[model samples]
Target: MSVALEVKNTYEDFILEKDILYFRVGEHGLVSFHGKNYHIKKRLNTEEIQKMTSDSSFFKVNTDCYVNTRKIQHIGDGKVYFEVRGSESKYTTITKLRQHRLKEIVLQQKGEA
Candidate 1:
């Protein structure tokens, strides 16, 4: 079973760490799960959310987005791919600076380190 990370939002619900694809900073933090986006309570930013979801599976992909590595279908050619609901796939390009870090994490996860 995936570990559950409780995040208090307007709905006051718990979100599974594995179900989270990414978190982005907007007016409030937006936590993406599958195809849905949840507004994280006003106080938390992507960095705080990262701390809350602290695990090897989560990493900051850019200045505004933090991605869950476990949710990644693949990462290459500067794109980070994620599996969503149906026929559609979601992808976000990583910054050149952070791309190398993400690749390291992916390799470490695969026990290739």
Candidate 2:
């Protein structure tokens, strides 16, 4: 589960508003978002991650990292599966559980399931 909140930023007497969003998990995980590395204190199962990435707003750039799909540059698959765009490099390979979940997500996203 995750909590969604609103955020307000002020700079030079100017105020900017944004959403304060976070994902919840039992253990912490590593992620890279918008060129910055983030330590996700919440741990989530592969199925949850897959569901999250199914949304257009999110993308599974790697097995351990789910990025915003809008940020993806390109996707490649082979012995070394990866996604690279600009300064971002994401790995898509993972354990069997994650791999299976990823495949399900992909199929769901493509409307094949």
Highest-scoring model, TM-score: 1
Each prediction's TM-score versus the true structure: 0.61, 0.30
TM-score attained by model 1: 0.61
Model 1 spans > 4 angstroms off: 1-14, 28-50, 53-56, 84-87
> Once superposed on the true structure, which residue ranges of model 2 sit more than 4 Å away at CA?
1-31, 34-64, 67-92
lDDT of 1 by residue, 1-113 (tens): 89999665534454546446766655566544332344343456778666655655667777667777776777878878886555566777788788888888887777853
Which one is best on lDDT? 1
RMSD of 1: 7.1
Q: What is residue 30's positional error in candidate 2, in angstroms?
A: 8.6
